[model samples]
Target: MQQHPFQISRKIEYGMRAMIFLASQPMDRTVPFREIARRMDVPEDFLAKILKTLVERNMVRSTRGAHGGYALARPAREVSFLDVIEAVEGPVVVNVCQDGSSHDSCKATGSCTMYGVWKLGQQRMLEVYRHATLDRLAMSDLRVPEPAPEAPTRPAAESRRVE
Candidate 1:
């Protein structure tokens, strides 16, 4: 899906899910690829790419060989949401105008009425994400809500006219 200005990419979302799952698991435990994929409901192939980026960023560690899997490189408390987002998608920019590389492209750099708005918005977002550590998220009740029970259905013959 194409990501809007504020919306995070699917890769970043999946990476967050994967990170939360790992943080919830015992620190000593290394979760396998299949298990993370199943629990996060993330496609294995896509998740592999996300994981690779995270591993490269030093946010996640991968183990090879028998009984091998993945785990956070550091304690969950040390890893923040911003870290995960930045690992998968570079510095979190709320607007293109905030991105340094795109600064020259925009006709209005210092004169734009919305520049301050975007700057403040990006600052606030970064602060929130930076403070949202994985340990806190993992400790919260983030389990998927149970599916509601199905309503009772009428028997096929009951509502039908005999004629």
Candidate 2:
């Protein structure tokens, strides 16, 4: 299998999945971690770390006890893709030149011809991300399909042929 050059990290991917699931669920209902993991097909341990990051960022709320679980801290409409991505991956940077901290490293920060292009691209990317809120994603037709049941096999002895 070929790997894509530009791809989100597993952390970000899983975080998005969990967020969407939570958004789709009733705001009054607290979903269990196991249910989220199973429905989203994310590893439990990996989901745990992602959830921890989200919880710390105040994007998700966690509860303790039998009926307690997890839910979105804010309304789904208030949370955007940028929020989730930035929550997990930090600020999105199109290139090293776009990073303020790396401006000193790049000698052509101000004079590069491609600077405008990178800036425009970065701006557009962030705009799209900011526009894609959890509410929109949850409402989209992106549900995980249930697995098909396995067919029953016949006994080997019943398949014997007469000579």
Candidate 3:
């Protein structure tokens, strides 16, 4: 059986949730870690580690002492889903060949005819992820704003005589 590489860790889920929570709050407010943990229903310690990783990636900012916790380093619109995923999970890659390295070791590496197809699929997947941002994800209503009303048009005199 061919083992598929690359899976999104539970940490990625928790990290995204934490980011959304921060995005929903006041921009300048520092939410408590425990509060985020409780709200997200994620294990406190595990979520803390995820948060630490986010901080190191500069995706989130941490504050110390009372009334301190975490907040997004940038606006939600400025952060992409890819950013959140990469923050906790590292760079995304589906296959060994997609990593752009020498394919000399494995007997089936270069000879595999499906390598190009797999690489193309990986690129498409990345493009989709790149376009999906946290702000778009958080916006529950997907309606387009209505256009401004136009000036009323005058009816032709002949058309007004229909009565």
Q: After superposition, how far is residue 108 of candidate 2 from its true place, in Å?
A: 2.8
Best by TM-score: 2
Q: Residues 1-163, candidate 3, lDDT per residue (tens digit)?
A: 5533555677888998888778776668898899889877889999989999999999999999988999889988899888999888877877777776665534697579878787899899888888888776763322223579999888798468665
lDDT string, candidate 1, 1-163, tens digits? 6656666678888999999998887777788888899987999999988888999999999999888999989999999999998888888777788886766657886677887788898899889999999999894443434579999999999989997
Q: After superposition, how far is residue 108 of candidate 1 from its true place, in Å?
A: 2.0
A best-first ranking of the candidates according to their TM-score comes to: 2, 1, 3
Off by over 4 Å in 1: 1-3, 101-105, 139-163
Against the true structure, what is every candidate's RMSD? Answer: 12.4, 11.4, 10.4
For model 3 the TM-score comes to 0.76
Sorted by lDDT, highest first, which candidate order results? 2, 1, 3
RMSD of 1: 12.4
lDDT of each prediction vs. the true structure?
0.86, 0.88, 0.81
Positional deviation of 162 in candidate 3, in angstroms?
57
